[model samples]
Target: MRIQKRTAVAVAVALIGSLTLIGAGTVTATAEETSVALPSASFRDIVVDGVHDRVFVSDPTGGSIVVTDYAGTVVQQITAEEGAAGLALSADSSTLYVALSTAGAIAEIDTATLTETHRYPTGSDTSPQNLAMAGGKLWFGYTVGSSGGIGSLDVASADPAATLVPSGRYWYYAPALASSPADPDVLVAGEEGVSPATLAVYDTATGGLQKRAERLFTSSPSISFLNDFAVTADGQNIVVAANNPYDHQIVRLSDLSSNGSYSSWQFPNAVAVATDGTVATGAVGDFVKTYRPGSTWPSLHEYGVNDLQRDGLAWAPDENRLFAITGFSYGSAPTLHVLPDAGKLDTTLDVQAPATSRKGKDLTVTGRLSAAEPFPAGTTVEVTRTDAEHPAGTPVGTFPVSTATGEFTFTERPRGTGDITYTATYKGDGLHTAATSQTTVTITK
Candidate 1:
């Protein structure tokens, strides 16, 4: 397999296709602002299998998928039979399932062997797009061979002794797949002209209807022709993608385990949740809404990715990677980008502070932490300066992130000028916290 090092622009040198990074000049926005610099790497499709310790990405145009370590080196590559589009890695990250949309077949690849060992016949016109793994079975999207509409395939559970679960159910056009929130139910996200595109769940043990959202397909005029989803952890949520009029959404899974009943919990956009436990979504023209579990309405935040637009997003189990799949709409293979380390995401820092000083004056740099989540008081928040450097006179003191509201302050009088940066060592309880960048203050002279 051809492995290429990253170039500034996705050049036309060959294996995949030309991945040009036509850089644009810097543009700016506010709190809903252009704060963090966009991340580097990109792939056609990106999936991080924490169980396997590597990321799996599909190369539809290239006809192969490249696997890489957390450090971003190509570790393995799987070339599909013909037109490889959909990719599904098992929960354990050992087996991989690839869909041959044109060939109307699904090939199961042994990740360890990096080889295709099992193949199933889906009929012609069966355009398999994305495949999902659940309850040790494989479910993929398809178009009916005859009438031609969406459908799915289910592989039977194999006997424990056999590694290959060879005998199982293979379906089409009946009950299509619906997306779910971190649950074990098989989920599919779109339907033909149906409102809200019904999200259904079947019992893994019975392969029968356990629960579903009957008219979720009818969010008329708001959402349409939806398909495919990236589920949140616990499968309690999923971000829906629809085209033929493209728009996106992050909706909640109807919790049905309790009564095998139907319900819609009004969740939205899986990508927003990828940022933190918070779910953020809506059209660019609409408000960029944000919310966690207990909040009333989602708080609004807005910004643009000058060179990038995200159609899908994922959060790792370790919660350190806020990753996105880019280049889907522009006809380029998806680029896998890792933005702001998860450890750095500090919700504890989302509270309001007392104040700041005059540009040239030596003011105490300080703020109050929200509470004790992952980063409590005493957590080290590292400070660095850009532009001209913290105007020479500011005394750099390490302040404590208060345990109560986490009120923290550092005595750093101005030396000169700078784009002040704070790298917080957040031991906070939030999902995205690894080492987050606090607001960058520019000191003026």
Candidate 2:
């Protein structure tokens, strides 16, 4: 076992080679994107367990689950039942659940041992396609013969208990499922393989599916050929990706009302939300975008990938890494792409002052600290004065910026003449990058 594991690791690293960041837009100087070629011919789902520092990729075609370290180094490939497809991790991440579509059961694996410990059967001929754990149950979207629907397995129950929700029988194909820890009682499902796909939000607080809100996209801001979707960490909004929208749609989970959308390249296909409220979206084309919560614009770190698979993105809980599966072309072999510092949103700070001013006069200094997300209330920007006397740049003042606008203004008196420069600096917060901008003012007698 030791020798085989060592060889597998070596082969995985060799296949990874060295990847260079290409076709990036506003990526931070320190951000690096890496890729590792997988041994599988196809991919169905990707899940990251920050607790274990492991990434699990399910391959129905290979009937296996490929495991890798945080750096994309192959750790082990656990053989699963036939048709290993959708994957979900337990809330604690100690256990991983895999949906075996052909076997009509869910395989439970101990994450630490990388071994299949149990197989819970859904039913004969019931092919589960997607899995979501919420409300203390393992909910799944499955197909029974010609019709498809959703079901759940009671993980806490002593017996292998499964319930096929009767309300889910109306779908043409199996839907994709998503849930959030922030809202533990909510489960979201979207229909597959159909235009104007039906999306529904369910309340699982009662231990059974109760329809909360449903939408069929036939009106304005229409969606078609639903590819993937996700619920925000706070469970307040659902992000949708469809073939016709040309961008990811965001809506209130309460009423299914349009909240906003994240604009992306053609063919928006995948969307994932980090625990820290960072949103990562993918497209079939070259670009993938990450946005801070409630921001319509892609964060400054939006970068490009070759071609992302449908439902191919996942984020580490700490936001340190983003895992994406990509192929050079449709129906080709896929590779796992790991982006380092995936949560760092770049910021912009600009200082404005009078172009010309007289010595001993007060000047209005104005600036804005721009980021993917708004700064909180009471956030301040530090200003420094640089003139003939203070070339080292003396601290002038720190003023609060508008929480809504990120704009700030202050008054400064220049004692020295000649060209004076005012520098505005936003030191950055946990998820944002520091930024500095300066504007010079000529001071005369």
Candidate 3:
């Protein structure tokens, strides 16, 4: 395996085989972007297992899934089939499902052990390109010999079966697929080609068509494709990455009506929605732009990452981090970029106790969690105690940060003597890193 870092210009030039400027348009770059090198030359998709604190990248050419931590550190590499194109994490985050396009199979990798435990045949002559998990099943899209469609497998069955969705086929490319997080039974499939593009919603349980929207890109005469799309966690909005013109379109799921359209970047290939309702779009180069729920303009804060064209983006709400897979096209090497929320956090801890108190006397511990502003109400802080008897220390209690003052306090009595120490920790939310503070008190005979 090889690892090397390349700039946006270098990646773009390498991908196009020359720096002749493939497109007539230009993207605005406001700040510098950061990037981490990967060991693979080709990439297809990215997924984050926030519960396990790991990011997975599918490298179809390398036939491996590269795993990294929230810090972008390479932790492990699991060998896969020749064409490991799409990836999806189990709802519980225990198993990672990968589509082996060339092998015509899907493999399940144990997230903890970083090993492949099982493989199931997709039973399709065409190669599968995208994978989604919903309704306790693994769904995939495939295209071969001018025919394409969607298929799914029951994840819970002892002997899973691959069943094609009724009337799910298209004339050309496999439609891009996304499932609603709020309602697993709801799915959105989009088709992009020379003909008029189309979008359809399906009910996974009954295999029924809920709604279909055609003529997605009415203005573009050139071939159009659905580069990427996502459904808001609340199941209220569907966002699509319309390529030819490089526009983002939001549609209200309730009525299949266009909510709004925002044209901010040139050729955005990936888009994702956070649990907090923030929308992120990954364009051809340098930066990932985020926007507030109701606003079409970019957010005040932006995540700058390498110009390597991004193909997939996933948000890990637990860590407040975004995982992006780069180098989708061209001969450029694939890279995984881990971007944490942009900002700094401040925290403090204090102790109130006699310098030399009785062994069983009560002691008070207090702390305040602060950043640019006070944290949200009901935020939690962990308290731990350490003494000579138990040098390793033990978690004693947990307290909530006050909404009004950002203060948290708790009382405890020392059971043993000899320089007891109290420590408080705030496990940073989506916008901050974990911080800790400690104070010591002595016990008398």
- Give the candidates in order of TM-score, highest first: 2, 3, 1
Candidate scoring better on lDDT of 1 and 3: 3
Q: What would the per-residue lDDT of candidate 1 be over residues 1-445, giving only the tens digit for each residue?
A: 1111222221212111112211111111111111221122233345667665666666656677666655555676666556676666666667777777667777777777677888877665566655665544566656555332333456554521112121123333323343433566655434433344544444443443333543344433245444344455456655554442344444555542211111113222224344234443433223233334333232322323222333344446554444444444455544544443422322433211123335656554444333213344346544443334444423243556655544455655556554555433334444323333344555666
Distance from true position, residue 413, model 2, in Å? 29
lDDT of 3 at 114: 91
lDDT of 2 by residue, 145-255 (tens): 888888999998888677888654388888789999988989988886798878898989888889989888886668889999999988899999888788888888998
Error of 1 at 179 (Å): 5.2
Candidate 3 per-residue lDDT over residues 360-421, each given as its tens digit: 87866555554433567668978788888779998888888887756667877778777877
The candidate maximizing TM-score is 2
> What are the RMSD figures for all models against the true structure?
12.7, 11.8, 12.7
Each model's TM-score, in the order given? 0.57, 0.74, 0.69
Q: Report lDDT (Cα) of residue 136, candidate 3.
A: 68
Task: Point out the worst 10-residue segment of candidate 3 by lDDT.
Answer: 22-31
